[model samples]
Target: MHVVVNAATSADGKLSSRRREQIAISGEKDFARVDRLRADSDAVVVGVGTVLADDPSLTVKDEQLCERRREQGDPEQPARIVVDSTGRTPTDAAIVDDAASTYVCLSEAAPVDRRMDLADRAELVTAGEDRVDLLRAFAALEAAGLERIMVEGGGELIFSLFEAGLVDELRVFVGPTVIGGRDAPTLADGDGFVAEFPTLTLESLERVDDGALLIWRADG
Candidate 1:
């Protein structure tokens, strides 16, 4: 599967404030760009932390884009996938809505009741014992015919993807604003790399609104 990780960060490389709240870092042009990205993907993935913090619908927003997908005999919106180890995704989360197919990747350790609750709203794919095994989950996703995946992330998930060498591309929109806080989330945050950092080759750069878009391909 082709996996792309996309995100918007402030000038200081912060995804959001320490409060973990959603903040608008990109402008209308960038938003439209992201909509196009979503429309082109087979599935859009995110971690549970993002779902809880942003509650994004993860649907294609442009009607023209939806029409184009329909013309190509594709769904109006791409499928949505969430990495929730313990099944903490709220049943009524926007991702679980009928706008698109939703998949919750859970771990075997997730409670049966919680898994049952999510099963009613979304497809459940259980993998790891304590955490959602990304490789296994992605294998299942690929088997289900999702070849192109776009990951709009929370830092933890992004870090994990890179750590597992699953990411194919990294795209970041650096906005003009500055959000400075030590506890703020960065583009990739988990236990950060100490050695043997992931190498990325610059793919492209463009100006979007008041910010810059930098895309890098993962170097093997």
Candidate 2:
């Protein structure tokens, strides 16, 4: 399976404010590019923190793009996957709507009631004991035919994917704005790597709506 991570960050390398509020860092052109990326992927993945913070639909928004996907014998929108260790995803979250198939990755430690409730709306995949094991969760996704997975993350999830050596590519849109805060979420936010940091090969760089788009391929 191919895992591609995409994010939009301020010039200061912050994904959002320190308060974890969602902000508009990218412009219209970047939004369109993200829509296209969603339309082309088999599934979109995010962490539970993102769900609680932004509550994004994670569906392709362009009608034309949906049509194109349909013509290619694909679903109107890609599947949505959420990595929630303890099943904190709200039952009414947009990702669980009928617009697309939804999968919530949970751990065995999740409350039975919450798991049952979410199971009514979204498929539940148990991977770890205390936390959602990304490796096992992704393996299950791959077995379900979700080969092209796009990760639209908060920060911790992104770091976990890199730490697990599961990320294949990364595409970042560096917007013109500067959101500066010591506690602000950056592109990858987990325990900082001390040694053996992930390496990347620059694939392409281009100017997009008042911003720059940078693409990199993970080096093994």
Candidate 3:
């Protein structure tokens, strides 16, 4: 299974401003690019923090992409997967509004009631004890026939995935603007790596509307 990380950040490396809410770092062209990526993947992954902050629909919005997927015998939209360690994703979030199949990945620490509450609306998978073990999450996702996964993240999820060494490809959009607050979220947010930091080989770079798109493959 291939795990791809996709993120758009300011030139200063912040995903959002000091407000820590959903910020538009990508332009319409970037959004269309993301929709194409979503159409190419079997599942789209994100963390609960993204749900709380952005309330994204996580669906492929381009009509042509939808048609292309359908022609290829794929679902019109990729399955929406949320890494909610404690199962706090709201039932009313846009991801759970019946527009697509949704899965809530939880930790064993999540309350039974929370599990039950989400059972009807979305499938639940427990991946770890105190937190969502991303490695196990990958196995479960692959087992469920979602072989290609695209992770659209908040910083914590990005750090967790990179820390686990699970990322195979990374696509980053560097917007021309800057959100430089010290507390602003970046591409990755977590404790520093205990040992060697992972590296990537630049695969491609292209100019987008008012920014640049960089794609990298994890260096072995």
Clashes of each: 0, 0, 0
Q: Can you write out model 1's per-residue Cα lDDT over 31-70, one digit (the tens) per residue?
A: 9999999999999999999999999999999999999999
Segments of candidate 2 deviating more than 4 angstroms: none
- Per-residue lDDT tens digits for candidate 2, residues 1-220, read 9999999999999999999999999988999999999999999999999999999889999999999999999999999999999989999999999999999999999999999999999989999999988999999999999999999997999999999999999999999999999999999999979999999999999999789999999996
- The reply for model 1, stretches above 4 Å from the true place, is none
What overall lDDT goes with each candidate model? 0.96, 0.96, 0.92
lDDT of 2: 0.96
Candidate 2 has its poorest 10 consecutive residues by lDDT at 22-31
lDDT of 3: 0.92
RMSD, every candidate, angstroms: 0.6, 0.6, 0.9
How do the predictions measure up, each by TM-score? 0.99, 0.99, 0.97
